[model samples]
Target: MKEYKPSFLFRNAHVNTCFPTFFRKVEIEYRRQRVLLRKDDFLDFDWVEKGNSKIIVLCHGLEGSSQSHYIKAFSRYFSERSWDVLALNYRSCSKEPNPSPFFYVAGKGDEIATALKLTSEYQEVVLIGFSLGANKVLDYLGKEEKIPKNVKMGVAVSPPCDLKESSLLFSKGWNRIYEQYFLKQLKRKVIEKEKKYPNILKEIGISIEKVQKATSLVEFDHLVTSQLAGCSDAYDYYEKNSSLFHLRKIHHPTLILTALDDPMMSEHCYPREEVKNNVWLHLETPQYGGHISYASFEKEYWLEKFVFETVNQFQNRK
Candidate 1:
């Protein structure tokens, strides 16, 4: 693993974390496809094809889509290198309201499995996920008894592997900003769902008013996510969905990237002990790189460059 040195321009965690949202601008042309799942739930995937045999699937974070800065940057980086890139958007995240009230959660591994099945045409497939999507990817890879032959490797960036601890940390000082930002978007989605499908809230036994009152991610999960996802409560959802406990089950080579000072994650999120015991798992903890942001003044973005370099090394080893 390469060492990640923070740039002098943005040494602070918050600055490196929040700088990409404003400073980074990347645009890539994609061919969109709507994948229909077994349960009839649909997910949208934005594909950038370079007529290559190797394909990379990119999963965005909570409330994020294919247009997210990190996804766009990574997609553009790999696409330029002639690797086919697919940015998979979770339900209701494509700026289009999904028919089902149940949205994507951290532990929804089946969705990722279905996505890989859909894109099984590629000879080589690499899974790359950020934040919540990272958790989902890790959970899926770990829990599955048999991984797809096309899946050569995986990379999870800034994943909250321990969901419960991370959720608690979100309500703490400075982290509340991210919690509020996510809650606002979640509440808006619920409201939109109610407007489009009037029976959705009724079916879930949750009201828009109750969802609006949720100021924290835990409250939102308890009231809305848990009920819709068939979990008894927020704790159950977190316990069942968190990837930390399942890391030992993973069979394929996987890289887990995280920062020590990520505002959205707690120290427990790193799972150092689990990674140490698991030969298949490689953990990279840089002192900097806030959340999904690893920006440097010298490059397009440090994270993207690092990811490309790491994946290239993995390919070379293979």
Candidate 2:
């Protein structure tokens, strides 16, 4: 792994965490495309063309879209490097609401497979997923016996490998702040879904009142996410979906990036033992970098530069 030296002025974890959201500026022009899925559902993709055969597919974190700062930053970085970029937005995550009421979850690898099929024309492809999307990528690679020949490698940043553990952490102090933010967005989406598919919430045994009363992510997941996704409950959902157990089965060359100080994940989220045993997996846990944010005053966003360089190294070695 390349050495990471964070700027001294903003080395504090929280400072590095919050700096980019307020200071970083990313503007990338993209041509939007909607991908139709098998179940009559659709995913929105933002394409930044560089007229190159090599392509990179970016999967954003929970509640994130193509306009996310990290997505835009990487899109611009790879586009400048002459690589085609496709930023996948999960169902209902784009400008238009999805027709189906069911949305994406952390371990929904099938959706990633659907996205990969759409990129068959590219000679080379790399999957880069952040947070929740990262878990989806790892799950997909592990479960599939064979991956697309064009997909060379994958990079997952700050993934919640163990969904149950991460959920427990989110219900506690400080972490509750993050939980509340996510819950607000999720609730809004659920309400929107209710408007289009009125029977969805009823079918899942979740009422609009119960959803409005949700105070934590755990409660929300149990009441809505788990039911809508066909799990018995939140625990069952986490048990079936968490990527930690699937890590050992991955055959593709993959890099996992996380930080010891990441507020969103518990220590269990880092699969150090699994990575040590798996030849295909590479793990890097820096001393700092909160969640997906790895900002430095000098570089503004260190994660973007690190990912670009690491991916390039992987490409050259391949």
What lDDT is reached at residue 273 by model 1? Answer: 94
lDDT of 1 by residue, 1-318 (tens): 666787676678889888888887888899999887646478888989878998899989999999999999988889888799988888889988888777888885566787788678899899999999999889988888777899999899999999999999989999888889999999999899889888777775887788888889999999988887789999999999999989998888899999887888888888899988989899998888889998776547778888889888888998
lDDT of each: 0.87, 0.85
Over all chains combined, what TM-score does candidate 2 have? 0.95
TM-score each candidate.
Answer: 0.96, 0.95
lDDT of 2 by residue, 1-318 (tens): 555667775567667666777888889999998777656588788898867999889999989999988899889888888799989888878966677767888895566787788789999999999999899888888878768999988899999999999999998877777788899999998888888777766775788889899998889989888887889989999988999989999888899999888888888899999999999999999887877887765543678778888888888886
What lDDT would candidate 2 get against the real structure? 0.85
Clashing pairs in 2: none
